[model samples]
Target: MSGADFIDARAQGRHDWARTLGTVALTVAGVAVVLVPTRLLVLPWLQANGADMPEPLRSGLLALMAGLIFTGAMAGLFLGVRLLHGRSVRSLVTTAPRLRWGQTLLGFGLSGLLVGGLGWLLDPGAVKPLAEVDPRILGFSAMAMLVGFSIQAPAEEVVFRGYLLQVARRVFRSGAAAVVLSVALFTLAHLGYGLESALFSLTSAIGLTVCVLLLGGLEFAMGAHVANNLVVAFLFQDLSDANAPSAAGVDWTELAANIVVMGVLVATAAVLARRRVSP
Candidate 1:
């Protein structure tokens, strides 16, 4: 069989071509729609005109704007596919999510340890202050952060791995191509982070992209992304400055550790997937 034929065979029952195409179209439309109202109109308007706006108001507005953008993108993909491509809304909602919850949680725990543990190692002082927070406040923060990150991270996975990667796999006929595209876009989405941050994000995306492709699911990647961000937003207090091993840059030791941990987790997931496929 030809390469396209091979890929088509593999993805045959998994996704509908028309639906994937519709999702791509809507995702692009969502980007165009959100830019004007959210980015141009609200952000600058608030900063320039709302000098009296409290810090909380400013932060809340920004978060709302970001959430809107995220929601728009997801709606475009999910709704666009259903409306334009005539796909089932239920299937669209759950596409590309062959979740192995156990493996996914393992991946999350492993990556968290690597990332968080390294920060502790490189600067032993890093872990000290984390324990100083009030238990009640920390508990609230952890719950809030996890809920927020869960929304954002899964939407990201659906857009990139579930939608973009599937279409790319159809066109390129290689999982690697889909992975590369996904990783590049993933990094680009965080470009506001500057050079170092972007570099670190790119490295992180590669590791994640590989996990998604090899395991043929977004669950593990979603778990790892959420866990990593949660640690930064909740558990950790002080962060290193921009230059010396900041959040953006993945340390060599930790990066290696993530590879091992994520590798094992994905490998186990792949084995489970194979068993599921077997007669």
Candidate 2:
């Protein structure tokens, strides 16, 4: 089903905790498998393949942690959707009719320009290095990043806004509380992003929660998330310096623009969702 259809279904009533919990449990199981590496045979095989014990083991641990989070989120979201017949939770497995190309481009363009502009003004020294990587390595790196993000983003959306927020909404009977919890969980999930990105992720998380409340469903968040990953993976070449040093205070210009644009979008979406869901 399409994202719009999923949202419409979820808006009908409340979500079910039992199905949601089942989903969470299954996801947890999956994460455990990835993290713990059950069979004694598995470690020997990895060692034979030249997998760095310390690095691969460390990476696997981190991956396991991240995978667990996404798994829980996915389970919760789908459980809610299944229970509510798509009424109380959105579907991350679905896609919407393409947003108007112009509108989508405009949104992305504006956000990038604002962020880049702010970087230029507040941290001029941080202009990214002219990417000098070998073409093959660059291609491979891009592919790897794309694959990682593709698997991760939907999993995250389903868990955070789709399942957890939906369940919270049922409990609180308030949109704001659910959004807050979702944002907090989302921030916690980014613990692997390091201190700076985690901090920015929290800010971004708040922005996203507001986006959800205003925009009415997970679709918008998914789009924004994809757009962000695409930029980091394809457009900007460096991963090491993703967060360059910045000026002491927030960039008012970029911050203001982001607030205004997102605020307007959210307000419009919330109004529309209200109209659709209300009698």
Candidate 3:
């Protein structure tokens, strides 16, 4: 199915304006509830005790905590889709009977190669070596990242490319408009990171949205997001480190590289999707 076909599938369920608005409101409340208490109560405790932990472990724990908060949002989305919209959560994922796992895995492999390879090629010093860290600590941190990002990335795709995209398509009645609105909202959500970060996010959102429309599902976008986060977090120097370059800093070379990578990934997805449907 194409993007229009995917959106048209919404007609199979109760996709009235009231239900769509309710889902959005409920999802926002769910995220706020998770974030507020965690920031107020849990983060301080972690900060106080985090000094005793190894640096890698401390960072990993923080990532895990942040990722876990999205569980509430995912729950709210699922509930809203099932109860309010009277549809299965699968409807938010794909028009097919089952998710195309091959596409998901392919997306991960291709994105991991492109991002990691181009990142190292563009700035060799940015890539971290595994041998620099203690083996045990590295192992634990890797595990934390794997679990945390696995949850976090897919949950995000579910919200933006999945639910929000469908809702936008229904409301706007135009695929191009829906894509633009979804990408804009996705970039806005990351604006706190700074203008440079938001620009990269805008590039990423456009590529991911293109993949969703071309491939007609969330799987590829979900996999690509997970790979992008994992590669950046594990291989590249820590962006969150106090000593690292400011997120606000503009590097034209890096920005250009990001655009190139996103363009290539979208093209790759388009080719693969076409091949799948070809005789």
Candidate 4:
């Protein structure tokens, strides 16, 4: 199979209208359920305990707790895929029978190198210390971020690229149609980001989707997605409200740089996949 080929032999009878629509409903419901902890459970706790902390620390606390809760989305995704689509979780995960650990790591490391390198080169020293965080809090928060983003990003890929793309391709009966609609839906989900931020996200969605399609699975894309989020979030931790990562105005130059990074990332993944497959 070549990088451009993505029709999984395992998903033959899976993607009908009902299941596709159900995936959306279930995915959204899953997110809403997961938010319960962050909004209802963690918010009060953080507010009560972190009253004296700097905005960044409180924000970090919110993310830490939320990350733990966000694992629900992955569960919900699997459940919906099973109940609604009558398919195994593996259908939405990889073209292969099981997950590919090596590709996942490759995607994570390569995308991180490109994105973090470009970001630092273009806007050096953009991040500043949010506050004089306690050593314990800082250490814990770092781990929390890794845990949270790891689950959060992959869960998102399962819903967006995995579930959505597969269903759309089945429904529309065109790879182009599936790709465009999936990318469009992903872009629309980030309407809160405004035009520039939406554009940035759109570009990113395309890149990650390309990575998934090329690698014939979600492992690499999930890893790339997580790495992308990590660089953007951590480097800019103190620059903006954690609650609103896009609250800070988007800069055109930064947007341009991000697009380039995403584009290069996609291209690199394609090249890497081709080399491994044919050579």
Candidate 5:
């Protein structure tokens, strides 16, 4: 089936305004359930006692907690799909009976290569060397980042590109409308980072949405998102550092590079999709 047809067929039946609203509400509550307690209780406790802990250990713990919020979101989405929509969680991932791991891996490798290479070429100093890190803490921090982003990235994809996109397409009965709405929402989700950051997110969301429509699945988008974040976090920035600079703005050059990288990713997805359909 075509990607649009797959989305339409998957979203067919059982989708109504009420269920859609319920799913969104549940997702919010799910995030809150993890976020609220972490902010009010866990964070305070960590601040009080974390000073004595090793920096790497403390940072890893924080990453773990942050990652758990997405766990809650995924949980809520699965429950809502099962109960309200009477569909399996797998339906949100792909039209196929099983996930296309090869596509996902290809996306991860390609995006990581493009983003990491671009960042390195732009500012070689930005790349953190593993040898410079404290060997004792390196394993802990690396593992924590891997685990955290593994959940965090895929959860965002499941929520935005998978559920939201499919439902929006069904409701609007226009793939274009669905892509625009989902891209807007996705961009808004990053607005707190600043206009430049939001614009970058807009570019990324558009590319990812295109991947979903072309490949008829979330696997490629999920992998690409994960790789992009990992490349930024592990190489360019220290996520364990609370005082690390936010993505407030980027220079024109960086913005141009981001656009190019996104374009390449979308083009790659298009090529792959074409091959899949070709005899």
Candidate 6:
């Protein structure tokens, strides 16, 4: 059950292209509909009312709100795979002969270690000293963010690599094409963050897609993404500056470094995935 086999199996079946495309439309629309309650409505409410609360508590509230919103999309990915493609939900998850949860968890640990370490080494400015966080609040805030990222990471992986990659392959007939198209689409999904974030996202999408393609599933991508988010949101919790948009601009140096880091992640995952399948 290689990715190729999964794609071919779906393509050979009696499924309508229009219906598959409809699934894509529905999923994206669902995200927008969901954001109305989770982000659009709630974010302003938080800004107005949450300011009086402890900063850590405010942050934790936002994180929990985001997690619930993203989890909805993750569930949609499952339904989309089954109802639209007439394929098992598991097939879109992994093309490996069997699901490998151990390897997936390993991917999470490896990515968290490597990305967190490398980000600190390359840009000393990327992280603040842990001493800055109040010991009382840090533990709770971190837990809240961890829950948020856990749901957010798999949402992106499942939609971009798991669902759309399969569609891209059927339509384009090339893995490279699927990867490129999916990366571009994923970048567009970040349009609200402005150009820099949109472009920066492309690097990550490419890296994760490469990992998914090589590892025969989205597990490595999901793990890597979740860990990456934690590193940025936690370790990089700062004395100054933030990933939160203050202005719109692209930093080429930062973007290039991101690409290099992502490439390393994909290469590492490939090696690990290989070891797991070896006789």
- Candidate 6 wrong stretches, greater than 4 Å: 1-3, 6-14, 25-33, 39-41, 50-57, 129-132, 191-195, 237-253, 276-279
Spell out the clash pairs found in candidate 1.
none
TM-score of each: 0.67, 0.60, 0.91, 0.85, 0.89, 0.82
lDDT of 4: 0.71
The models' CA-based lDDT, in order, is: 0.59, 0.51, 0.80, 0.71, 0.80, 0.71
Most TM-score-accurate candidate: 3
- What RMSD value applies to candidate 4? 3.0
In order of TM-score, best first, we have 3, 5, 4, 6, 1, 2
Q: Could you tell me the lDDT of residue 274 within candidate 6?
A: 78
RMSD of each: 5.9, 7.2, 2.4, 3.0, 2.6, 3.4
Clash totals in order: 0, 7, 0, 0, 0, 0
Candidate 5 segments whose C-alpha is farther than 4 A from its true place: 9-11, 45-62, 240-249
Which ten contiguous residues of candidate 2 have the minimum total lDDT?
53-62
Candidate 4 lDDT, tens digit per residue, 1-279? 432344443545476677767766776677788787577876777667776775445545555555656676676667777887787778677777668888789878987887778887876777546456667766666666677778778877877787777777777777788889889988887655457657877888888888887877788888888787776666555423533545457778888887787787778778867886784
- lDDT for 79 in candidate 2 is 55
Off by over 4 Å in 3: 49-55, 237-248
The local distance difference test score of model 6 is 0.71
lDDT of 5 by residue, 1-279 (tens): 457865774654488889878877888889899999889988898889887765455656666786898998888888887788777788788887788998889888988999999999999987776676687787887688778878988898888888888888878989888888989999998665456677788888888888888888889888888888777776776554534335655577788888898888889988988988999
For model 1, give the 10-residue run with minimal summed lDDT. 1-10
Over 1-279, each residue of candidate 1 has an lDDT whose tens digit, in order, gives 122322233443344566666667788788669866766777788668556643223333443455567676777876775676555433322334344576568767866776677666666654534365566645554555566566676678777666666567767877678768878998898665446557666767776666665555666777787777656544443221212435645456655554555565556556655765678
Worst 10 residues of 4 by lDDT: 1-10
Name every residue pair that clashes in candidate 4: none
